[model samples]
Target chain A: MISSIGILTSWLLFLLLALVFITNNLLKINIYVRLIVFLNVCLFLLLEIGLFFDDFTVSYISNYSASTTPPLYKFASLWGALDGSILLWNLTLSLFMYFYLKNFKINTSNVDIKIYSSILFFFVGYTIFSSSPFAGCIEANEIGCNLSTLLPFQDLVSSQIGRGPNPLLQNHPLMAIHPPFLYIGYVGMSAPFVASVSRLVLKETSSEWVNVAQKLTFIPWLFLTIGISLGAVWSYEVLGWGGYWAWDPVENVSFIPWLLSTAFLHSAKVTKHNNSLLNWNYVLVGLMFLSTLFGTFITRSGVLISVHAFSNGTIGTYLLIGMLIFSLLFLYIGSINRRYFISSEKLKNKFGRSGFFIANNILLFSSAIVVFIGTIYPLFYETIFSRQITIGRNYFDVLVGPILLLLIFLMIFSIKLSIKNINLKKLYEDNIIFINSSLLISIIFLMLFNRSFNLVVTISISFILISLITLNIIKNFNKKGNSSYWAGQIAHLGLGVLAIGIILNFTQSFSQEIEINSFDNFIFSENNYQIYDIVQENLPEKTELKLPISNGKITKFTSLNIFNNSSQQAISSPAIFRNLIKDSYISIKSINNNTFKLIVRENFGISIIWIGLFITSTSFLPKLKLRK
Target chain B: MKSKKFSLILIIILIFLSFYKISNESRFEKWSKILLCPVCQGEVIYDSPSEYASDMKDILQEQIKTGYTDEQIYNFWVTRYGERIVTDNIARNFEIILIPIAIISIFIIIFLRKINAKK
Candidate 1:
């Protein structure tokens, strides 16, 4: 009877599946899919509302929620734990599945919709059977099951009172926005997977699916980009470090699918324009879905050690088996229908714009493969030689750095290159002015600063790219360009600015850890910083360090707040002085009365990276208008 | 023909410079990046904020000042801790290095073959 909630959830999914089958095989009405989707959404919302209300009879509510928690965190607790996260994933999938079904009903067959329905049902079923949030409690005591039973009860009396979400999850508001956006992006992959599978089932090789796949891929891709960026911002702010990206396995797993989908989006266009690379596009789409599942498996399996990994459980094995089955099914379908997907058409100019796109795909896909292998290599090594080894930032930097530079190089050339012809004369005439200006600017930049050759080259490349994109955008707008064209140009411009910001940050950011007592003075990066005051507050039960930093002309006062919690370790909030060119940040490592160790860092050009992200995400808004 | 030759020469120079720049980074920088932070999960010594990571950085800097080779410094860490103390050298990670190269090579071959196919 305790499992009744999961059982009831599964039964609802089953009924929805039955209705979909009936709609496909017998009724032929589109409204049934809509009805099922609406019902599923309502069920999920009701369960979450029950959680918000602290309905401790439900096992999940008792596990992640408490009566004393704030309303907002109580709502976020739905995704703070593993089981509820899966339910949220299922809900997001149904939402997207509903829209996808509505959009494609007129264009695609009922069988295609049924296949989509089946995919949604399988996920919902997986959640109910393997990792359901709706399991019920036996006793339903007032304080709920002592979920803190697993932890060493330092204060057993307080532990029995109440509990809250995971400390890291509750620390920041971004947790609410970040995980759901990521899940929505991950679950949105079902659309393209359904489209790709439906095409294979229908035995059609035309470019129809390419169009649908391309359009649908962008929706998830945009959400994924925002999710990744927000995740980076969260880490930068909350992880107590100034660095945003650490190239961790969890980060790499999420990134790999974005890379694959980017390749697929580019190649889908090639498949349409050149009538080539059809098989490549299909393979990329399949890989995108596979990467999502693989990422989910890694996060849930707990085979790897990561700060971002979810709680370990048997659900991982279920996800792994599901991944293997889907991968094998794709392989079988690919091998059997390989020839139909292949095309005999060739590129008009083998080394033209289309060629650049192909090169882009190669670079992206190869880097994705590198990241995937790097992520799994530790597991493989552990299984084989019984050794644990981690591939860190250096491995990724060594491989991906050059590939990214090459991508930028290709992007610069390809944008100006002709699509179907090798017009050397025209190309030269068009680019000679831009090339000369770029060189002049590079020379001036080198003269202005004493820097390494690599830094100079990178800056010059980014400058040239920015200038080129600006010129192109101006020309296009003068011609009364369409929104799609502007979107591409704006997005590319954002990448140019972002690359410059990243390069500058990597080369120039510096940090120093210093032990300080009260009234200690330290000079760093041409600034003198003095610990002016230390205040301890009682009501908030926090310590605040006041440090005044001065560079003769500009003086800034920054405070680092330290909060002590009885149940968990003390948490420190770093103080940051944000500037357009640089961010001066200080974090406290440990504090005792007047003496503490402080980490001071000067982060250069990070603001530009944030600005670039904003511009790039905004570029997609034009696409919505274009769709109309 | 002259412009083509000039562009080709420019590209070769660019390639050589980039290759040289990557290989010739300062020894202190390379050594600090090579070690793993003892207390942090999967973070390199240079990026982690742990006291152990700070101590490792001090050891690396001292060794570099004493004119120790990168290998000798790496051996110092490995001798004290296990081989897990340092970031896995891709140079020594045969399986890890081989699989990625093979995968990329195969994909490139397939990609080239597709592009070169006749209508």
Candidate 2:
């Protein structure tokens, strides 16, 4: 009954949205009508929460919310499946729309809200009619059938044993955080997008729209970065793989938008400063919005078989049509307004600040293009040759590596040169000490570690760039530069730090896989590890292996559990002995009666990545405050 | 001015040295990395520990021993397992190469046109 009401409310919200769209005036839309739409979304949210706890009649709840399922996982089941996930997407969009309407309530012609609402309406309508969570239970021969729909005798067995959420999702707490943050990041892009469209439609070249786009872009971009990082952490922790990023299609899709948005952010600043890269900015904003939709389509449409893709369906066609229509609309609008985006100034020097922004945009956009090709090339290949293909991380790493190094070079070089004047003499004079010291330090550091000669050169370059930036920041602080300058300096420092972390961790980290019998003491890398005991636990049936690593002053226990379910999956909950310099990680990969396979890894200086990310995120808070 | 020249030379030397090192890497290692793992997502057969990946790597090693060039070995895999074996077939499919080139070309064209419009 609640499911039926939720579907009904969605239709009502759609009607209200259409009425507002027809008039194209947000102010004319009745307050009661807007209030009712908000209420309708709230009602659906409440119903979902209620069904999660109580209503087994709802097939989704019955399938996911088992008696033994943890309370935390029960709440997470709201987005465990396609239908529930769409509902959550619609809810987030509506909530944002409601807030947008209220925020711009005084304005007579807020077409941004109308456009946003229409988008929300289309999604909500899609959710209700096509992928409704409230649909009646279908009779199936599966083990976990909807017990409420079955006969009394059938309910006796099936009702007691529910299927629960996907085992992989239920395994980790990060699953609860990763998907919501990603969805918010995805949905949050709608505002800047609509604002960009509004600028073109209103035929205005005011810096107002650019300012709006910049501020709105940060909110989503911030969440997207965190979401991506959380996903990497989740993969490292839960997948039993010692690696973080694999350049999977799902990972690439999320990264594509981040890259485009980074380009947009940089170009948007140029648009404000010199009224340049206006059309570039527009294309990026449009692509960002399209890419979010594209990402959603990839994950939900199941056109590609991935660990992350939803079950196969007809949604891919729908999404493809939507993307085409949106692309055509953008092209149509952009051609008409081509004259408006043209700037009066050309870049005077290639080494100037504006040139830096331009270079950054090119690099970022190029990377995004490469990633997009690598991701979609498989599908493209299948279409042309009627054969399956997969493009792995090597394809991307080979392209992106040189581009990133070039970007780092551009960053330091541009920072050294002034915008108006190109003084190579003064630039060299200012950076001479830093340059010498960085090269000296990097060479010595690499020699100390006795790393490969190739790594020495790259690390030396990275060190030099980082040192140059750090010295500049110190000089700026000594001169008492403003917080905004500091923000940029700190953020750039974070990037350098992150790059160093990635390089060192990638080059220096060592892993070994060993098979052991019962309890044994093993010595590796000047450390002793004891597999003290292996105990089998009840309540889901997991065999837990306790591994204690002792290093003179400290001892840490890492548990590896083999979940004996239908899948027969064994996962090791790795214990990380983290220090400022390095992390020693150990986990059990698999267990066969008396024999166990263990993976031990030492990650060198990877803590800086997390620290760098923290610093970078905090730098944006000041900008948010200034905008507010 | 002397320092600037010296630094420029140093950067050039560093880049050259790195390139020299990169060029010296074995073709067998390079080919092992180019092929995608059939069972695992985003994993190259060179890095994956699966039985299939190990077998594929052994074949690549055997092919290299027989004096088959990287292109020929890649072709052998393609014929054996279709286009799915190699992650990047830049030599086989010209369309894949066009993707980045076309995108970069479009950007350059637009940027150049925009700059020239003002001039």
Candidate 3:
């Protein structure tokens, strides 16, 4: 108990000093002070185990006792609930904060770094004060609840039997790695914000920070790519949403940051080359930070009525307020720095890459804003007008589609230009034959397909992917030092694959709602389902039903499970989902007998998405060599 | 000197054109983002892909090309679906709180920056 208390205490202290770390104008403390603070935070987390396991006659342990919960869950419980998850976010933020500080070159004493570090500190501190997971369930003791009740089944299992992790979390191998990877992407926006803060606070009238920001920018974008991909994979095989992206607010939340960061990544390059888009870079990074804040708010705040946003509370309000304050501060600073921007660049052309960047940012922000308002509109309506409103896929698809086509066109052409001016006449003279031939081929392919417009969209987008692949392949030319390029290519290709999947799945998916008793599979689309084969006997903690899905050509089955254990099952029916790129969604929603419901959707292009993700995931391993 | 003048003139023309196109596209995207999808109740008009949504988007595109302010476009939708159609239930209160909050926070930050500048 004492040991765990120590761990909790260290994080509390770390969280408290966060503001001092981020805002140098308030307190420009020594770098060592922040470092010591985080060191203590890490120590506290380590100490928590003792308090957790001790058979103490204490407040938290008596209710959430070590005896009732699984040890794995007990450990995982650090982020399993509201208070604990907040603590987890703070801990992660603290870890990143310390690491970021430690990584700085000792001699590089730029004054803006104070505010940069302070931002990280403030974020961590607010997270601790507002939402700490290391909060001992001391309040449980205030009511004299059973210690067993304190430690839910999973936590008890964590104490005794090492119950498999949350069956939903355990369903696919991707589940294990997805969330941590996402947190990296979500929090990694700090790097660019740090750079942007330098631009704002120190008035570093140089492009060097943009260069630094660019070099580091791809990292979070890449992680976010993987996270979104893995999330889709998780959903396809689990949520039984049949499709990967449900346009769910949570899914859109992830995509919004990805879009902003992507715009930032691209715009930063323009700034890197021509010293143009300095102002745009500020906007992009600020937007990226806001997206992260908004995503946290959406996921945490119950204001949004999405199944995910249903987890709303005072913590949500605190987070939303935190996000609003953070956004306003950054926005204000960015506006103030308007004078320092490389304003009125003389080299921009009306219909070139700069235009592309501008259009892309607008579209990206538009996408994020639409999502932001839609996600929160329900709560606002309820509070202001005493009316409840629900917004769904109808709200998103209309606006996002045409912009996607526009983006695809931009992607195809934007990369071929740079600062010293493209000798367009000379390049056109050189590549006219190539460009004309490609355009002709695309036209012919579309004409032949009869759905020429859709073909145009797909072909142009695919060409962009192909062009990027060819360019990178040629540019790197078997180079070992080009891991960044390799990562970019893999990620770009992943986007292409995802896009193709989206188009094909939308155009070609077949689904049927089926009622099944212990042994029947309903046939739909290009596949046959033989039921009864997927049901597996109860595991130690839960019961599972597997659906074997097979196209006559390929035999693959997805399994679904209903967690029956009283300790394991609670709030919502969380299921284990595996995306074999074939079929199988293991859901805990079914209660058993004739009443079980499963919507089996057979999709054709899902595998393209899987393959795309696999390629991207493979790229991550090769990067161990690039660690320096 | 003649060549420099020509190049500078060309650059200005190109930059203006780029800015023009960007501004135009951004307007359409901005207005589209705020519009509610008729088919998908909670989603934005931009991210939806249904038939009704695509038709509405086409109309929105026409409005943008023809030059409609965001408020005008919003009003058009509001007239069609009532005021609930224009602002999301969440953003309705959002504008009221968001404006004051943005103002206050901006003021505070500016004040701080100024104070620091003095010290």
Best by DockQ: 1
> lDDT tens string, model 2, A300-402?
7877766677763656776777778777877887888877766445556555667777888889988898888888888877898898877665566667767
- Runs with alpha carbons beyond 4 Å of true place in candidate 2: A23-37, A40-44, A102-108, A140-142, A145-160, A342-349, A413-418, A450-454, A472-486, A540-568, A579-582, A624-628, B1-37, B40-82, B86-98
Report interface Cα RMSD per prediction.
5.1, 4.6, 13.5
Q: Report the C-alpha lDDT of model 1 over B1-119, residue by residue, as the tens digit.
A: 23545544554554444444333336765666668776676667666666677677777889889999867887798888766676756777666677888999998998798767774
Best by TM-score: 1
Could you tell me the lDDT of residue A132 within candidate 1?
63
Better of 1 and 3 by DockQ: 1
The per-model DockQ list reads 0.33, 0.30, 0.03
How well does each candidate superpose onto the true structure, as a TM-score? Answer: 0.88, 0.87, 0.69
Model 3 chain A: which ten-residue window has the lowest total lDDT?
A149-158
Per-residue accuracy of model 1 over A275-316 as CA lDDT, tens digit each: 787777778888899889999888778877776887557778
Better by TM-score, candidate 3 or 2? 2
Query: Model 2 in CAPRI terms: which quality?
Result: acceptable
Better of 1 and 2 by TM-score: 1
* Candidate 2 per-residue lDDT over residues B22-60, each given as its tens digit: 233366657766887777655676545455665787788
Against the true structure, what is model 1's DockQ?
A: 0.33
